[model samples]
Target: DAQAAICMVRGHAAEWNISADKIGFLGFSAGGGVAIASTMSATQMERPNFLCTNFGPSLMPVTVPADAPPLLIMTSADHPNVAAGLVALFMEWKKAGANAEMHIYGDGTGPYELMPETGETTTESWSRQMLQWLKSKRFI
Candidate 1:
């Protein structure tokens, strides 16, 4: 489904005024697992230009592809299993020489909001950090 969505978006890029080369995948929670799976399994034509997973860890074993898309992983340090899984994933990506970045916020668990509910916390800047990662990768 994720690959199909990429295909669909690319197919309609001109009509949507979207840049086909800048297409990316971003998922939160369980959806993040899906995004990773899609990238791992994708053909070159089906792969997203980049991937961002927020508070989501792969539910299955990970084997980083040599051509894996640039990855951005964000989760809370206190989120135990999730934090550990993402760290492992990051390591795998690095091992494969894939481009990857991660942020584990100390002050919270679960997903962080794009904007803070109370005073600002490091976690609240997740979206901004992701954008920076994307820009650094020249995907934006």
Candidate 2:
């Protein structure tokens, strides 16, 4: 769970010179499940400072906390699996009065292809989008 990870980091923070507040979570697919779990966990320490979900499931209901971490969500409009859920989650988060942002990519060509790290593909640029969000929050 995120609690263990956060605690470990916090425990070594002084020697590692990394602040607990700067730690965040970014997840894709199944990993996003974990991210969501971490965000909605009852233990505050288990939560990340910020979170990014890339085309993840949204059915896991959570009571958005006042201190809910900033969130960035992305999904291809044409994605066969999780696009609708991701968008639903974006709206849900907004309605929950949480700090949330979303991006729905893809054109007539269908969802952007997930290219290799060295390759430049439209869907692949989603990583850059995440980075930009992190930058806006001064996480990078």
Candidate 3:
């Protein structure tokens, strides 16, 4: 899903007058997993999956830029899958020389949804922190 969205976004970049190199992706939880995977797994402007071939280009380009803007990952410390996945993804990003960041909350009131009613926890506030982080990184 992440790869597909990126392919679609990049395929339409020219329509929006945005550079394919300037487009970036971000997500949380499973979405986060997918975003991280998409960044590491795909080549510059190339869709990571053959499914993206549904869209056309002048020609299939090689060496699509792998380096993306920094990532902001958020998860609960107790959520091993989320924690480990994001951590592993972060390591991969650094190894690939792509910038990345992560925030893990120590089980501070479990399952605080990013919904208005739930009231953002210090953990949930990572969303805000992520925004600041992205701004600090000049990603926004």
Q: Estimate each model's TM-score.
A: 0.88, 0.81, 0.61
Winning candidate number (TM-score): 1
Instruction: For candidate 1, give the lDDT.
Output: 0.83
Q: Candidates' lDDT values, in order?
A: 0.83, 0.73, 0.52
Cα deviation at 81, candidate 3, in Å, is: 4.0
lDDT of 2 by residue, 1-140 (tens): 56688777767877899887877888887677778777787366667788888767645556667668888987766664577677766677787788899887664323356445446565557878888899999877
lDDT for 75 (candidate 3): 59
Of 2 and 3, which scores higher on lDDT? Answer: 2
Q: Model 2, poorest ten-residue lDDT window? A: 107-116
**lDDT tens per residue, model 1, 1-140:** 99999999988989999898889999988889999998898888788999999988744578998888889998887678888889899999999999899988775444543325555554557867887888888877
Ordered from best to worst TM-score, the candidate numbers read 1, 2, 3
- Candidate 2 stretches with Cα past 4 Å from truth are 107-119
The C-alpha stretches of model 1 lying farther than 4 A from their native spots are: 107-109, 112-118, 121-123
Cα error, residue 27 of model 3, in Å, equals 2.8
Q: Quick one: best lDDT, which candidate?
A: 1
